[model samples]
Every structure is written in structure tokens, then in C-alpha cells.
Target: MVLRYVRRHFKPLLGIKGLWTFRHTPLAMYWAKLALKDMLVETVLKDENLPPDVTNAHWIAHVVSYAGYLAKIRYEGYDTNDDSKTHWVHFCKDLYRIGYCADNHLPIVPPLNVIQQKQEWREWIIKRVTGGYTMHALTQQLIAYDNDTQLRKGTEVEVLDKFSISRMRVGYVKEVIGHRVHVRYWDTDADDQDLSNSFWCHEQSDAINVVGWSKTVGHAISAPAGYDPAEIGNSSVIKKNPGVNIQVGMKLEAVDPLKLSAISAATVVKVLKHGYLMVHIDSAGHALTQTYRGVESDANHGNNRFCYHVTSPLIFPCGFCKENNIELQPPIEFKTDNFDWNEYFKATGAKPLPLKDLEKEVIDHGFTEGAKLEAVDVMEPNLICVATVKRVIGRLLRIGFDGWEDNYDQWADATSCDLFPIGWCQLMNYDLQPPHVENQEPGLKPVSPGVKRIKSKSGTASRSKRQSATSSSD
Candidate 1:
């Protein structure tokens, strides 16, 4: 009703009495953002072709266009209405005029009744709904995002600041410029015509990249896969300290599991015997930003007890995130239940074991590239399959799953319990899952007998030593 009265009386004042000065007001700016966002969204029926990419592009274009107009208005000293708004260059000549309230006395208008307000809102919504969108639904969600965290490349984000067609899509940041983002998102939008299309997005006022207290949800930053992870398991020996062992612990760089980016500043905390360590990051969020003066918001706050192998790529030296220009997020203080890992290890017998002796065993076994073997599928522990050695790199054997794509292939460190010799599955009373080719003959012919001897010898000896060492440490 206030808006209605204002529009009625303010029409005359609006023409030469420009209102764009409200751009400086925080409330007005926020209001404008919502208004602009809502203006681009259309209510459609369930059957409507609401491809996320098209919708995203549409909304992005709207924001850019509006931003451009605002920029023009600020740069040029001109007031514009629907009519009589001359060329954009008019403002370039003069300073923009400012408008302010002159008196405390305001025009009194009849207020809207509660029922009338509801009716008006219902009508407004009905007007926005198209012909097909009136269909009913079972569940409706009204999720509120509290924070609009700054976005950077590698942020794990879901699209919904929702004017775009790609609303609810989950993806990682591929690139970003200013307020615009290039999201490599994935969604099951089968009906969407432009599912594969890349959409440029302008960040929303309430865009949330990370949550402060949601433990069940995913983190705001995504660990990058572009870098090769450290392979300590492939090596028989590693230094006691991180960064120094691989590269120096005090200044070593590592991937922040809470917010994965290129790298973050971290210090070694504790060296777990089984190829892992506890680390403390100075700041997980803004790890990418260069430190010119003061520390960040989350600096030196948590134990950040992430256990990483000596060769894990997640660890890195200071300034790694900044040097790479990767988007960083404040580390989430994940709330987990307290439990003693030592007791759990003793109970389950699943303690992490050192790989040094196992590496020597694999090397001594004479297992080389192109060697064939039978191996257990970690995803399906009950199944064993024919596998081929793709290469011998360091202390790990890169094995390709036979008859299966490389997606299921693996790099098995000598200490990994997953690998086995040919016919070992048959010997264990576990059925083997061979390749489904009718003409397939035995591929690991020589490996079968040799594998039996290696398994009974080095494999058994390594297991005994690993158990004994872990027990002694415990």
C-alpha cells in the first residue's frame, strides 16, 4: 500500500526527480538485487521446457544488462524513466542529481487489510503463473541460504540463486571473474534441451558457498584433481616430517579437505605411524589470498586434524593457493562425535600399516609391467577378477581391470591388501569373476604358479610384520 500510494503521488516527481540515487543505500541495493532476480524467473508448469542452462543464461544476461545500466547511470549524470530517457551518454556531461526527503510529514494513505493483502499477494502470484504451472505437487521446499560467501574457482557449489535454468545443479567452479562464475555443474536434467551448455552466472546477494553449521552437507571448496596426489604407499620409506619428507613440514602445502583448492598453509602436527599425519592450517578460508598485513578470519583456529599420507597431494607449502589463484573457502569446523581411534584400531584390526617392507617384497617378487594377476575388487569385496599390470611405478603396481574400463583400474601399493596372485582367489575358496569372453584362455599362465609362491612367501611375511609393528605401536 505504501508503494501503491508512492507510485500514485510520486509519478510527477519521478521524471526529472531521479531515484537511482538509492544505489548508495544498502537496503535499496539489496531490494534491487531481489527485484532484478525475481523479474527474470517465470512460473512454468511441470511439463514446461525449463532447461537450467537457458534459464541460467537468461538470468545472467539480465543481471549483466542491469549492472551495465546502473554503471551507465552512475557514470553519466542523467535521470531516466521509461519514456524520455535519452541516450546513455547524456550522463557523461553532468554530475548525477541527488534526491532526499525534505520533511517528516508523509502522505497518509488507506492501509491494506490483512485479507486484502493476502488476496493481493495471491493474485500477484497467480498472474505470474503460466497456463501449465498450476499443477499440484506433493512436497515443497523453502530452503533459506544465510550467507553469500565470496566465490572462487574450485568452490563446490550448487546453482540456485534460482533465476537460472540450472537451479539446484551441483558443480565445482571452473573459473571466475569479478562477480561472474563459470560453473562446471552436473545435473540430471534429461528434459533440458541445453544440458551441456555452459552458463555464466552473476553471484546473488545471498549466494552461499559454505555453511557454518551443517555437518551433513558438503563443503564449500572442492579438492582439485588436476595435481597428481602423493603416492607414499608406492615407496618403501618416507621421512618422519611432512613437506620436508616429500618437499618440509613447517612450510609444506597440502589440500584442505574441508575446502580443497590448489593448496593451503599448514604445519605438521603429529606423525601417525601408518603413513599419515595430523596437520594444522593457519587458515583454511582465504588460503588463496596473499597475506599482506593482518591474518584471516579462521587463522590458527582449529586442530584441523586431517590425517594424510606422506605422499598425499593435499599437503603443500605456504602461498600455494595464492600462487595458483584457486578459489578458497574458510574451513568448516566439522562437528564429529568424539571417539578414540586407537581403541577402534585395536577392536577392528583395520589399523593403517607401513608399506616399506611390502614395497621390497613386491620388488623382490619380480612383478613387472604387463604381468597378469587376480585381484579383489574393493567395491565388491566378495568378487575377484582377472587383472593386468599396466605399469610398475615406484612401489605401486598400476593394475588395469581386465575386460573393464580404466575407471575401475587402480594403483596398488605393495602393502595394499587388495592385490593377489593368479589362482589365489581359487585357492581361498572364493569364486573368481573371469572375463566373459568365450575364447578367453588363461592370461596369467606363468603368473599362476609363481604367484602362489610369492603369496605364500613375501605376502605372508609382510602381513606378520605389519601386524606385529602395529601391535607394538598400539
Candidate 2:
């Protein structure tokens, strides 16, 4: 009935014949369902005078799309008994009301006493349906909900401040907007008791933690409030403190940060705590810039330098690419095809970090090809879209967003927080952005998996020989 209604009323708007050409394609079908759902939410659900049966049919369609079951239902058709249908209608009506409130920027009304037992669950549903919470906030809320200790305004916590070293400062939660939390610091020196020094950060940031985190880590708290740190318990979320023993002047082959496809010789210019290193690409052919007090002239060039944790998958031992039969982008002076690691290191007086140190940081991601997941669009940070693991390279993953062109695909670390498990959006009550379909051309040919294509300097498509590695370290 919903499909019949859509065909009759929206056929001209959606070009039914043209859409049918790609009915077999998952991207096309998903795009169509998203279009239908948006139309119903923006138009059909807003009409209060619409008949119950008609509204119910449209609601059922919208629900199906939201749940991502449109593809199966379109072909298999859905059947429900009278009781199930009634329950779904009520649920859909609630979803519509929540959406309406969000659209109008109105506060949601509390439920009556009769339905108070499920009030908390309903509020979570409201947040999910409205799609207003950030990923961090949603995850925190889920954790809090399970633990029955939701963090709200006035919650005392410790915020990590990293300067020359790390210090935990006492602060109170002022406000939470999406993933950002405004923390008002307690000033001990101010006689007037000013609490105006506040800043915002992601709720799940490693820098932010429960009140007693500093004690567990043996870090001194910069608290002026004279509060008893001993009374507070450790944070629920454990901080990642992996040991990495990299030092300055260490040489490694790293993926060029600017041109991600190329691997080049790099030197660590600065070594910081917690396995982080500031590496400068060798002989990058970029202009040298002056640094503070002329301390490191070459390091001042922003394009030539990149920050990476010592255990990063992008950085590897000197001869890694050569041993794996992968192409390497050598320094400007060396021939790309004939670059020798031994001679290059000898002339530069560069020492490669021991393989033992690098091995400790290597993680087993357990990701396989063709697996479906929700991945954050790095270019568009707010969007968590449907994606597939197109390829995996040693601790690196090639993520291709669904319904998007290959040009938008990105390479990410296997342990990157940007990648989430399937159904994460649903579990968090966040709305997943539908795969974009308008950009896809008709009769598009799929590229062969055996070859990798890259755009050359002359703006032409060129194929690169892709070598498959048997081990994750390769």
C-alpha cells in the first residue's frame, strides 16, 4: 500500500523509470528508500488532518527505511498481525512527535504517570529519533545509562592538561553540547572565587576523565579546591598508555602525509612522551622555513612535517616497502625506482629505530575484506556513513563509503576511532547518513580488484601494480 501510494504521488518527482534501471544495485535502492523517508518526514507526517490508515501506511514505510529493511521488505514484502501493527503504529506516532519537537526547537513534554515506568527509555528513544547527540556524548550516555550514573551539569571531574607534562585539573561540568563538554575550572588563588576559566572538549577525550583518574596514574592533580582526591574512584574508561621507546634522529619509511599513496624516507625531529613523534620527510623539495630562535629551520616547514605515534601503521622500518615489493617514493635526489636504503642512511647518518620497539606497538585489528561497517567521513566529520572494507594493508584499512565514488575513499588505521562496528548508529540513536547516489553515473563499470588506479600529475587515470601481502605486518 505504501509503495502504491509513493508510485502514484511521487513517481514524477523521483523518475520511476530511471530509478528502476538500478533497482538491482544496493546503493540505488538505499538511496530511493532515504528519499522516500525524507519526503514523508518533511511533508506527510506534518499533516495532522491526514486519515489514520493513510498516515499509518506512510509511517510503516518510514519506519522500514529508518531500520534499513527497505531492501528486504521491497522484495519479500512485510506481514504483521493486528497487535504488532497496532504497536508499531503507536511507536511510529511517538517517533513523529519527537521529530516534530526537534524540528520546531521545542522541549519534549514529559510522559504522564501511567507511562512513567518507561520514561527513561522513551527519553533515549527521543534523543535517538532527533539525531542531535554527538558520537562521544551518545557513547557516554549509553555507558552512564547502563551504570545508572549519567554525567550531567555540576558533575565534578578532572580534565587532563598536557603542557611540558600531564596534569589533572579539577573542574565541574558546566554544559554538554553533542560531543563537547564545557568545564569550569576551580581557581584556588583567586580571592573572589572566580570559576570563569572554562573550556570545552570532547566528552570521551583521553584528556577528560572522572575525578580520581590522576591518582590511579600517579599523576599530581593541580587542584586548588582542596578536595579529597582519595574519596573519588577511578574513571570507568581506561586510558591508553602503550609504551613506545622511539627517540629523536630515528629514521623510518613513512607514508607521505600530503600524498597518502606514496611512502618516503622520514626522520624523527622531536620525540615526545606517550610514543608520539614529529617526523620530517627527507629531501621533500619544499622551501625551508625559520623556527623559534632558528632552532630547527627545516622542521618549520609545515608540509614536510607530520605527527604520528611511534607505533603508527604509516611508519615502518627502512626496508619494509622494498621487502614487500611495494613501490616507494624516494627523496628528491634519488631515482624513484633505484633508491637504496643502505646508501641513503649511510650518507645521512640516520639510524633506523629497532624492529623490536616497533613490533610492540603493532595491533591485531582482525578486519577482513568485504566486511560492512559504519565509518566516520574524515572530510565531513559529523557524518557516520555506511562503508565497506575495500582492502587491508598491515594495520591499515581502505574504507570505501557506500553510494560514493572511489575518489572519496580513505585509508585509515585499523584501530582508528573513526571506524565503528555495524549498527553503531542504531545502538547510539544517531541517524546514519544515507549513501549518496546522485553522483553515480549510469552504467558505471566496476574497477578490477587486482589493479589499483591513481590520478597522475597530468590529470589522467594511471594504474599502479598492487602487491598483495600474506601477513598483517607486510
Candidate 3:
């Protein structure tokens, strides 16, 4: 009976191959039920014949796709996030309300909270698909920029003169780390080196213009030194390389950003806007078959997923490790010495991100392996510790905290502000922590200033001592 109903009602939608699959499938009843619900929602509740102004086809498609994806995942015995399920139920209720109102000739007015819920649903779906900011988010940022709000230190703004309210005076934002900004009018006769004449006001006060802002409002303004007025009108605010065309499910080799020494087989789980990607390292012991199932809580469950830009030097084409004679950490199933990349790709239906998209000019920061330097400990932000350059992959530097275990190592951009030249701490009058000696091998002296050492053996530190030392330094 279900098959007959589908043949008569959904033949055009499913076509011949789909009908044959449903007929032969054990889950025919389930598919038929889902089809019936979707049909009712589309034909009865949604009223697809409505004018384009009244109905958005793209939005409706996204809603339907989201519902279908969730239902399919649930049917496959995977747990989805509660918020997703709740939103779907709320959407169905909203559709029912609209249909009921139309049938009774009553006004269709949803409560403000219901309206807000729909907006939230829209945003959630976009985030899930895009993995980052959408056009709406970019627009909001532009609005904030145009309003001359969210001012930061070093911003140059135009302020209304206190003595003459009609006159607008250019000013430099001396400080804005706090809730208020300290401004010094450039038109004043006060000495350039003097901050005594600077005045403080709310950071978002209308009295500032953050340089380039006046150009947005059709006003002629003087550009500050090293400021380009043309840059203010450019819409490409997000820092993304051109021609990055990555998609979810594509396969590539990626360095474990945290474990910089290991490169593993990876899959693009999410393709975010502006060339960003959320990739899942397959060698982390999780099967690729379970990639989409329970992804929201993967981190808590010890899954190795990391976000990287498309042009990041850490990610490479499928044959990269083989060509470079580097060790490739394959998925758990293919952990043999004879692991085959071709077989893995065929089994998983994974394609490599095009090499053209990944190609970009590499910047050289001249950092070499085994070089000693000072680095800020990310975990203990206040502490600057002696560190060694462990690996230099393109513009990225793997920094190993000297005398510490490999687990405490970190990867940073070569030009990162977190790293400083040797002796920078002494120049700045900051107390620099020497390499921890407790974890070192017996008779191995602590790393001396300006002395380079080979990679040390993995060492361990007691949790109590580590915590105590970090706290005392703080």
C-alpha cells in the first residue's frame, strides 16, 4: 500500500531509481512515512504556489534539507544536538499555525519570541553549513564600522571641539583598553609627546570617527599617516586568499596543528566562509563512517578535529607525504606499512582539494630548527619561558618549551607576537623564567642563554610542581 501511494504521489519527485530502491528496501515503511509528512508540510502547510515575494524558495529548501538531514541521522541511530530537534519542532508548529490562520481567514501574526526563534534557527543552519560568518554577519560588522563604534587603541577619529561645537577636530586615540577612550586632539598646540591634554570619554561615544569612517558617510576627510582612504570602501574585510574552492568530504594530508611533528590523513568536515575549514584527522582512531554522527560533541569525546585556512601550509595534497618522504599517519583501519592511499580514497569516496587553490606565495621568517628563543606560554599567559624552535614548516614554527615534555609544545606563526627575540625580556625589564630543570635527564644542565640544543628526550613533570611553579610565577 505504501509503495502504491508513493508511485501515485511521489513518482515525479523520486524517479525510477528511487522507487526501485524503496521497493527493495527493508526501510520502505520508514521512507514512505517521511515522504507523506514532507508532502503534507509542503502542499498543505507551506502552500508552494504563493508569490515569490511571500515565499523564499532558497530559505524553504534550507529548512527542508536541515530537517531531512537530522531525520536521516537520527534514523541511523546517531544522536543529534537537542537545539536542532527543538528548532525543527518549533518550525513545524509555526507552519501549523500559519496554515490554521489561513484556513480560518484570521490574521497570521506570530509572537515576537516565535519570530526571534525563527531568526535563531536561520542563523544556526547558516553557521552549520558555512562554518563561519555569513553575509548577514559581514553586514553587521560593516554597520558597526560605519557607526564609528568598537573603537580600539591607535584609532584616529574626528571629535567635536569642546570650545567650538560646530568645528570637528581630528584626534588620536591614545588608549582604549578600558571602557573609555583617551583622546588627544591633533589640532591642539599641546606638545606631541604630551598626554596631559588628552581627555577620556566612553569608547563608543559619538564624538569619535576612527579614521576612514568619514569616507563611509560621504564626507571628505584627511587620511591619517599610513592610512589608505580607498581601503575603507573595500568590502573584502575577511582575510582570505583568492580562488580557495574547498568543500566538505574532500581528503588531504594535514599536520596535527597541536602535534606539529605528526602529519595525518584528514577530511574536510566543514567548509567555512573565506577559505576556512574544519577538518577531522582520520588517524585519531575515529572511523570516517562516524564523521557526521555526533560531531557537535566530538571534542569532548577525544576526536581530533581542527580548523585551518585553506591556504595553510600545514595541509597538503594527497601524495604530499609520499613525495616528501615524510611519515603519513593513516586511518586506524589502514595502519600497516603497506597502507595504500589509492585504496583509502576509493573506499571513502574522498577527493583532494585542488592544488591550485592551495598554492600561495610562502613568506619566510628565517626561523630554523633547534634555535633557542623566548616564547609566551599560552597556558600561563603571564609567563615568558625559554623555548626552542622544534620544526619550521613554511611560515609556521613548532615551539617546544625548553626542558618540558612534547605535550607542552605549541605551534605558532613565525611572525607571531607571542614569540620574542632572545634577550627581549631583559630589554623590557620582564622576569624571564628559565627552562624547568626537574624534568631533564640527570646531569643535563638547563638550557643556557643563546645556546642551541638538539631535541631533548621526552620528559615528565609532576602535576603539583607544574601548578605550583606556574602560580608562583604568576
Candidate 4:
């Protein structure tokens, strides 16, 4: 029996890679067998006398044939683009071959393609889990940081670069399960409003990554339509960052100390790197920057100095609270009711990069699309993001944070400290951020340059197996 065979050989199947993807393998195989039966019945009817005694060869053939069929129908022809169609087919054949070997304990000789896809799928699944809110709070409080945030419903947010790639966009949280938040961006098209189909990206301190999940048959969400948001302003959350310097103004999502439960819109009022940042909660109607010290944790308990860092989940881009329809705590009633950011940060204020200046920088630096680099995270200034230059505007690079999907990208200035040489992190002895890569090495993260393509609104894109480009300092 299949069950007996599986139990006897369970150790081998467990030892094989991609065992989790096969968590639902039986269900998938069952459906494939249903299709096979139809084909078999048709064949028997045509022959009129073929015996129904099924053999092990028949089972193996069925697995290969069905895998091939799934390859064509399910995975969008498995990367059969242009002249590489034959290569793609052979790759799928090798995948099936490996799957067969993993199950049967046959001498497995995996091809470059099979060895490759297994690596990719493994990494992909890991990213999906870490980038979503499915983990427990204690677990999150422990990882120090990750790809996404612990975003909850009704939280207004301005996700400029944390979980999305853009100048800035205002959105409201519809729901949060584990690590994924179903957000409704008011500026998005009708297609983007649907929560179930949307690919949600999770944010840690400085960077984020996207994980795709189903809206149906899982812990998905459906936010109420026509729900009006209160206390959330409709004005543009785009404010000129006064300083792009070490002691400069950077947009950060800061927790409103007054409103501990809500995600208040805040920014770096003062930057004191190596240990401190003075944050001002603007949209939440708070006054002045609150000083925060990073890296100092209780020696005995391991509790960090600031509950969150500049890249902390507690803080977000300016205007996050309003964008998400969450109310900001109103500033004290009568004393200096009006606040002027431009005047406040006049000396060392932050400003968004101009179109022409950014373009010139891109050309000067040769920061072409798909170029790789080490980037400083604006939120977690101390850490280096193993990144790629996703898009090149005149002088700015639309940056991709991690993994192959292009969803968790951000916009950064060409001359900002945020972008650095590939080996800067190692040279400085700072810990490089964890990768969303498959079989990645510590220092070198090489990726095959995927052709520049438009990123989908839902954050879903073709994840054809890509070989990462390793990094080396000259």
C-alpha cells in the first residue's frame, strides 16, 4: 500500500528537500489521479481489451506526466519565454525526476535546473512565513527584526519604503493575521482594493519582503466596503525630508507614546547615530521629537532601550496613522497650535530628491536597473540591506529590499548614505541583514538579472528561478 511504503521510507522523504511544499502533495496528487483516470478510461475504451492491472511503472509514469501537465497549466509554462522553451521543459522534467527520486529512494542525479528550483522554492516558502504576521508575538519580540511588521487592523499608515516601493502612499489596515496585513490604499486602483488577492509585504525595521497567500481557504480577509475613515486626513503625506545627512531628517514610523496602541505618523526630528534618534510624531498631533537610544538592552533581561528602533516596527513613515484611518493624538490645545516642519528642520531638514539631480546621479554612478549594492536602511541606520538598484530615475534608485519579488521596493537618493558599496557592511563589522535568497552565502548574494518588468499592483510577479550574483570588493 502507498501508506505502508511511505511509512517504511518516511526517513528518506523527510530527508529530501521541499518536504513542506509536499504538505499538500497528497491532495494535489489525488486531483492529478482523477485526471489520469479520465485519460485511462478513454484509452481503455479505444483499445477495448487493455487490462486494468496497474504497475509501479504506471504510477511513476503518471507522476511524471501529471507533473508535466501541471508544469504547463499551473506554473505559466514554467519560464518558457522566447528561445528558452526547451530549456524550461527539460528543467521541469528534471524537477519531476528529482521528486520521483525523493519519493522512491532511487539514485538521484539532479540536473542544474532541478537542484535550482528546489533551492528557490525552499527560500520562497521561508520568506512567506517570516514576512507575514502568522507568528506569535513572543516569537516576533525575539527575532530582533524581520521582513514585515506586526501591523494590526484600523491602523493608518504611510508605507513609503517600509513595505512598498514608492515615493509615498496612504493606506488603512483592513486586517492582520500573523505577519500579513490586508491594507486598502486609497490611491490604488480598483484592482488593488481587493484584500484577498493582494500580495502583502511585511516590514521589519529598515526593510521588508512580500509573501503571497490565498484570500479563500486560509486566514484571509474581506474588509467592509464604503467604510468611512475619521481623524485620518486626506492631504498628501509627502513632506520634504530636510536633511539627508548623518544628523539629518529621515521619515520614520514612530509609536505615539501617548497612544501606545496605534501606529502614529512620525519622523526623525534629530538623528544621533550609533545610539540615538529624536522622533517627532507629526500626524498624531504630537509636539517635538522624543529621544530614543538604540542597542542598549538590559544585560540580564535582553530588553532593548527603545521598544523599537528607527527601523522598528513601532515606527513608520510620516503620515502612516492618517493614511490608515487611525486617529492621531491631538497636540496640547492652546500652546503653539500650529507646527511648521520646514521651519523646524530648516538647518538640517530632509528633502526628497529632485527628478533631474537623481537622474544625473544614476548616470554618474552607473546605478542601472538590476545593479546590486549594499544599502543603509533609513530606519535601522546601523544595518546594511543587501539590495539591488531596482529602478533608476534621473538620480534616484528605486530599490528592491530582498528576494526575487519586486514588491518590497523603496525610493532612495543617489548621494544619501543609505546606498553604499557592496562590501561596506563587512568592512565596518556590522551585521548584514538576513537574506530572502535561496542557498545564499554570507557575503556574496548574486542573482541573475531579471529583465526589467513593471511591478504589479498586487505585488505578485513571475519568480522564474534566478541565479544570484555574488558580491566581491575590488
On TM-score, the leading prediction is 2
What number of clashing residue pairs does each candidate have, in the order they appear? Answer: 25, 0, 0, 40
Itemize residue pairs with steric clashes in candidate 3. none
Tens-place lDDT digits, model 4, residues 1-474: 211222233322111111111211112122322322112100001121112442222111111122211211112112434332221111111223213333555432222343356556445433433432211223222222322345656565533222222122355656543233345554455345332222233332122212211111111112245433332122222112233332334544444433233333344544443223455544422332221121222212211112222323244444444455444432233124443334334634554211111112123544566545555433333334556666664454566755635433545545443554433333333345544545644543433443453322222232222322112110
Q: Which pairs, if any, clash in model 2?
A: none
Query: What is candidate 1's lDDT per residue for 238-349, written digit by digit as tens?
Result: 3233233422233344544332212344556555553445555534232332221111222233224344555543343333334454332222232124333244346544
Expressed as tens digits, the lDDT of each residue in 288-386 for candidate 2 is 432211122343434456656566666788888788776666766665567888987788777786544545455555566765566655433335666
Model 3 CA lDDT for position 453:
31
My TM-score estimates for the predictions, one after another, are 0.24, 0.45, 0.41, 0.22
Off by over 4 Å in 4: 1-363, 404-408, 438-474
User: How displaced is residue 202 in candidate 4, in Å?
Assistant: 26
Report per-prediction Cα RMSD to one decimal.
Answer: 28.3, 15.6, 29.3, 22.4
lDDT of 3 at 199: 45
- From the highest lDDT down, the ranking of the candidates is 2, 3, 4, 1
Question: Which predicted model would earn the best lDDT?
Answer: 2
Task: Answer with 2 or 3, whichever has the higher TM-score.
Answer: 2
CA lDDT for candidate 1: 0.33
Model 2 Cα shift for residue 275 (angstroms):
3.7
| Candidate 3: stretches off by over 4 Å | 1-237, 257-261, 285-303, 378-383, 393-396, 428-431, 438-474
